[model samples]
Target: MLLVVEDDQAFAGILKNLSHEMGFQVLLAGTAEEALSLARDLTPSAIILDVGLPDQSGLSVLDRLKRNVHTRHIPIHVVSAGDHAQTALSLGAVGYMLKPVRREQVAEVLAKLEARLEQRMHRVLIVEDDERQRDAVSKLLASDDTETVTAGTAAECLELLRTQTFDCMVLDLSLPDTSGYALLETLSQQDAYSFPPVIVYTGRELSADDELRLRRYSKSIIIKGAKSPERLLDEVTLFLHQVVAELPEQQQNMIRQARNRDALLEGRRILVVEDDVRNVYALTNILEPRGALVEIARNGKEALERLATSQLHRELAVDLVLMDVMMPVMDGLTATRAIRENPAWAKLPIIALTAKAMPDDQQRCIEAGASDYMAKPLDVEKLLSLVRVWMPK
Candidate 1:
């Protein structure tokens, strides 16, 4: 559900219609008073607030929401006819969309808002000592519609968990009352299921044993200060979404079918041809971890050499090749075409790996007879997921 708070009746109606068309239940309010009342009643998934309101300024309403104990966690996107975007952001708006807004722009913002809400609604608790940090984290999670409760200390967090259920926790390792690690130990001992998935956000150094200990409790540990808050949120959002959600039976069957498809040969011998060491390392890291027997060919000549040798051996039939678009001796496009023209490897899966993410580049790669295309710097999780879907178990 979404709350659209715009004073312009026509605009509010348009927003409501668009939101409903986008498959969201939208509640509209033309004045700040109505908006506040509706917000209090609905506890909406996201709020699109106009800076201009009839009863009160939109900024004032936003301030009220943030200051209120009950409404502080609602994600608000400020929309304005005036150029106060910076001010709106500083005042705690998750996003600022200027008027007269395009339907596409609104849709995009709503999409992100929905994704964030889905992430938050699942269940997450934020534990931090600083009020500002707690609010910031809460706001971040709120944007995703993730149900988040903030605790100023470890003791408070434990108390909350005792009474309520949470799927995950974002804990500051340094707490005013008790150590985060000690809290983890305490939670672990309470009951097996009492310990929720935890993400450690701290500046303190964590040893391998500490990581292992957290993992034992089904927690993910991340070093703070190394990444921006946005990046941290992204990682947390992705991790929680993946770890907490179980695949539906239908989706699971689809995945199994994709895994068993004849076109996707199981445990197929793959040759990863790339020049960049980082790309090679990352690909190897993701694929090897997933049980793919990955062999590296640093350049096109080396790749061809491997193919030629494989043809002679008959035992080394390369079922798939991940060719980097750019490399020495012959680029991936040329190499892919060469391999495609050959009868033995014509039907083989040849996916292109390229730094180019533009649509034109993808089209070019397709024209070169590439079976599939993935962009670089590779998303390891996405890569692995795609591989599992395309390749047999």
Candidate 2:
């Protein structure tokens, strides 16, 4: 659900509709008090907060939400007509969407939140001797999305490790079983990649050496006390958010590669040899936008002519050639051999397009000195992959 905290009815209506179009249930809040009340009630997945609330300053509202255990996990975006983006961020807003926000800007902000929500937050394992303290830790950390498991001592924690995996760990320094120091040493021995991040949420005060020793095993040590719950949540949330924000770009690259888009495939010269005009147009449609300068030939005979001319003229040098298997004037096999015979164009790559079911077609093209062969009707991605391989970087 999306919560829009705005005083302007007209603009609020616009945002509500836009969010609905993007598949979010919209809730409207006109004042800071109303926004806070709605936030506590709905616990929105994301918030679009207007800084110009009637009752109180929006930053104050943001502060209140951040301090609350139930609402801080919900990401907030500051919307403003003025330059308060930096200030809002300092106060704990995840992002700032400037106003008057257009449909495109709203769409972009939604996309960011969508990406963030798609990632799973950390699964934490809490290790403590005191049952009350352990249950309290669980209560503070667990939400609709986060998972928590408790281990009372080092032996129990080690036993759990044999069967479970955690994203982060909350530890108690003083335990009846093995000490936290021993547990840290044991956990530190796991291969770096598989080791879960450890957070030392112990009450005991430490010397310089103990602190240094804990540093090798855990992410941080938070001494348990009055303000610790909020501080602990803040630290844990930072780790979880970091995982979402630093997610490998290749993971997000699935959409781009979905249509076999060659986004970075640019600035190359290619010649397409095909008798059919439709095939030429299809090839152009895909290649031109990728910044390729595509030239055309009616048949394999004209392909040879173009290759000969390109070899003689340096500026016209074709980076690669896509040769059609059959043509009215001359076949692609003969043109490929001709291209290979010339010492100047010998190193040039010529890929043959052939029927998908013909087993001997590829071997025939290879024998004729073609660089590679792809079956038609061209798979756009396979074609682009072949182009990338042959084109000069």
Candidate 3:
């Protein structure tokens, strides 16, 4: 399905009709809120966004979507009166279209999209010690036409590289023969496949310096223990260089369920306690697509109030909380303690988010009753992985 987010009804209709004629299932949203809601619920293949909106800038919406692990992977285009192609591209938009929309330009752009979707030429190298994790990630990534090569250690990976070429590499940092970092540095020196887009999948908690160093050779980083096998697939998809997202809704859902740990979070309620509006928006963008009903509070006090009122007045139960470590009035650690103190919510899953990666800080969150703790500037894929583990399948 392709979603066209536009405020102008007539223009929206024009785009919808045009999309359908071009062999696409179409969905339309008139406001940013509707756009966001539908983007999550429908999990559209691509989004044609309008810059001007009744509620918010399409650029803002794009920023939020790109931060989401699920929706971030979908292709998006900007359709607007003014040219925002440069800004949009910098922000992750695939392409842009000017207003006074024409069938020719739409056709040309979508033809390119269709060609991308129908792609089949791709191969990935999986470097990990755990066979179970390796297979799980490989399943999500291996379409019928794609080939996956697995290596149990950095040494094995190096040996494979000398003999065969690959489109991508999924690396686990800790290896028996050598460090994944050393392996990446080694690859950078080799003349093999032009530094194929690399993704780091590891259990090690990296410091800022470590992350900076890895960024030299890798496209992304996802911590392993955070239910991260699916994330490895996500990173692998980035290198696949193909597109086929224009399938029917049922087919799309089926494929999504298959790729997404073999299950989608269809009915779930989640609370995010964070003072940053942007973070809340990003989190909502990610969770909504996974079928979670999301609610937000700026700080711990409001979170408590919302939790209490929902349980007592609405007779509703919140399934999980994504709590921010630093906040006004009440911080995540304190909030975690308060929630645990209430017997009814004692065992509720609470995941802490912090800018700090200090061991002491993580321990504090755990001691205060948080189920897990993640470093912020979130690794989006890692965040979702953790959420999936804590929530019921």
RMSD of every candidate to native, in Å, equals 18.5, 22.5, 14.0
Candidate 1 local lDDT, 36-130, one digit each (tens)? 89988877877999987754467667756643435655778989987655445434466788888898998899888887676525677888998
Ten-residue segment with the worst summed lDDT in candidate 1? Answer: 258-267
Candidate 1: give the clashing pairs. 116-144, 117-144, 117-145, 120-145, 120-146, 120-147, 121-145, 121-146
lDDT of 2: 0.73
lDDT of 2 by residue, 221-332 (tens): 3333322555565556544543222333542232223223232244468999998888899999989987688999988889888888986887787889999988888888
Candidate 1 residue spans exceeding 4 A from truth: 1-267
Q: Which candidate has the top score in TM-score?
A: 3
Off by over 4 Å in 2: 1-264
lDDT of 1 at 286: 62
Better of 1 and 2 by TM-score: 2
Q: Between the candidate structures 1 and 3, which one is better when assessed by TM-score?
A: 3
Q: Write the per-residue lDDT of candidate 3 for residues 1-393, one digit (tens) a residue.
A: 889999999888887888888899988899877887888777888888998786546766776665454577677888889765654653456678888878789888777667656655668888888888888667656676667889998778888888877766777787888888888888788786345556676776566577667656434433323445444444444335233353234434444443543232445688999999899999988888776788899999999999998787643568889999999999888999999999988778899999888768877988999977788898776577567646532
Q: Candidate 3, which segments miss by more than 4 Å at Cα?
A: 1-54, 57-73, 77-115, 129-146, 153-168, 186-192, 216-218, 224-393
Task: Report the Cα lDDT for candidate 3.
Answer: 0.73
Model 3 alpha-carbon miss at residue 100, Å = 20
